[model samples]
Target: MAERTRPRPAADGAARNWLGLPAALAFIALVLLVDLAAAAHAVLIGFLALAPLLAAAVDTPRRTAAAAATATLAAVVAGLPSQTLGSLDHLLRVAVVIAVSIAAMYVARARTGREERIRRMTEIVRVTQRAILRDVPERVGGVTLRARYVSAYQEAGVGGDLYEVVPGPDRLRIIIGDVCGKGLPAVQLAAAVIGAFRQSAIVRTRLEEVAADLDALVAREPASTHGVTFVTAVLLEIRGPRLRVMSCGHPRPLLCRAGGSLVPLGTGTPKRPLGLGGDRGRPDTHRWDPGDRLLLYTDGMIEARDAAGRFFPVQRLARALSADSPEEALDAVWEAVRRHAGGPPRDDVALLLLQRLTPEPDTGGCGGPCPG
Candidate 1:
């Protein structure tokens, strides 16, 4: 029950108090007017019930019930001049109001209780997500790094897209993945995969060994996969002067060499996504020099569509390679993607970029950015 407790913010409570004042005043005004009416028709007396109903909008059920009692008392005292207390019509009108007020209080309490429960649950989910996802470090081991995760529209801001960086003594291994499907099920699988990768990435001697561990972990998950739990991912090992990559049916990462040149990495072939059976990712090593950048991302980057239904030009990232740092470069990529999509993305988006910073420009164009 405590887990379901959602405390209303002080600002919202303040707003309710301000609004409650007017509602309470409206009750008093209605009660006074009914008393002033010389010929109080039975119908005119029924309007007293409306006062308590208005109180339900802004006040707690207890306060609303108190206001209802006050209103009922006013109606009885005020109605004395127009009708005898012994009259059946007057007695019935009083009974009608008392019943309506009690009912209003009950309805208000039930509705408020349910809403508070939902608010509490949502808050818990947000806290849990932050703990699991963790923040990307601004700079690590002389390499500037930046990452971003965006949930799809009208969602809880948690998605199947997941990424993590495991920095070692002199090397850093990174994983960017997109779990199949969407919503809670997808998010759960994403967590499982990331958890496995994080635990094995630094400990496992080889990159393929890390991928194998993750694949076995996903295979054990209880997913209702119709043969495809698209566990697409890009795993990278970055050391002093080399970048070793292993792709598991994921999008090819972009490489930005010194002097603002960008090109796609790897041989550009689709390997089967992990968790579908054989997870084969041969080690592809690249000459990672100082002032070089590697951008890793999920499919959402390419899948985003504009207002005219045009796909976001991921190729446009090449033009943005001139950015000063990994953080600045990602900012440019995100802005471009947003502009291209014309608004929020239709799916979850994840972007991660790494920059090598040793001053010696090895812009010989082998592992350096080339024509995509």
Candidate 2:
């Protein structure tokens, strides 16, 4: 059997040292003085007298009832001792006050219970979302990885923006993209993109093919039968000494080299956003020198506006990345964006950073027909 649970005190016990008993006692004394004369209006006096008891009852219902009973007994003994009519009138007035106090306590208790239930439900939803979008691992292939996502609203998890890294046949493939809108509909589109990328990244050797696969998946969804979501994405493949990139209407990613120089990728022109057509523009490729870092992000970072209404320039972000580690670079970029936005962001932001590690020296080649 579930153990019987008593209703807990509504207020902190230590904070209310004497439990507000003194205030209840003073209110009762005032009511008694008003009742002593037959000219006193008991109805109006009873309403005013019950106010303190009702407040106390919200915190300590039992104590409130005790105070009400004691006040009523003392008033009858001192104020109505000489008249039978006065004694009956005082009894009726005290009864009404106690009834009102109990009713107020019940309402307060019900509201508190409802709020607690809602809080618990919200916590469960947050946990489920984290399980779906776990943080990017610290290391992928021969590169160190770090990433961060901040939702526009408090307690929100994994909105329309997304990022993922997958170990591929010849390289580590990375993706960072944003769905068209916000809220649940956008979240659904984001999940679809993440799921499609995970499968395509492993099978498709080229970054362009991986991007095309994602676009096909989103366009075929039943919800897309009428209208399509425009997803801006960048697919990256990091090989031993080479980096290939495919852009789909996404913001240009930044590259920070070992010697502390910043360069923006896909600078000249960019491809159209995904989910609208089947044709993809040409992919860009570059050599990955030792200690090079790649930074991919959603538009929320650059579009953030400061107090003077100036947008956070991508050039400034690239400069900051050159001197900072992957983790520090992520933090600096987010701080700059937040300061630009004044407070909390009004849109979802996602970022992914990858640092090329020094390649391990080759020892010996594996023999043909090795044991499976």
Off by over 4 Å in 2: 1-107, 359-372
Model 2 C-alpha lDDT per residue in residues 36-144, reported as the tens digit of each score: 5555545434644464454454345555555656655654454344444366776776666656656645654565567568667656656655654666778766888
Backbone clash tally (model 2)? 0
TM-score of 1: 0.73
**Clashes in model 1: which pairs?**
none
Tell me the lDDT of candidate 2: 0.68
- Give each prediction's root-mean-square deviation over alpha carbons: 5.6, 9.2
Q: CA lDDT of each candidate?
A: 0.76, 0.68
Prediction 1 global C-alpha lDDT:
0.76
Predicted structure with the largest TM-score when compared to the true one: 1
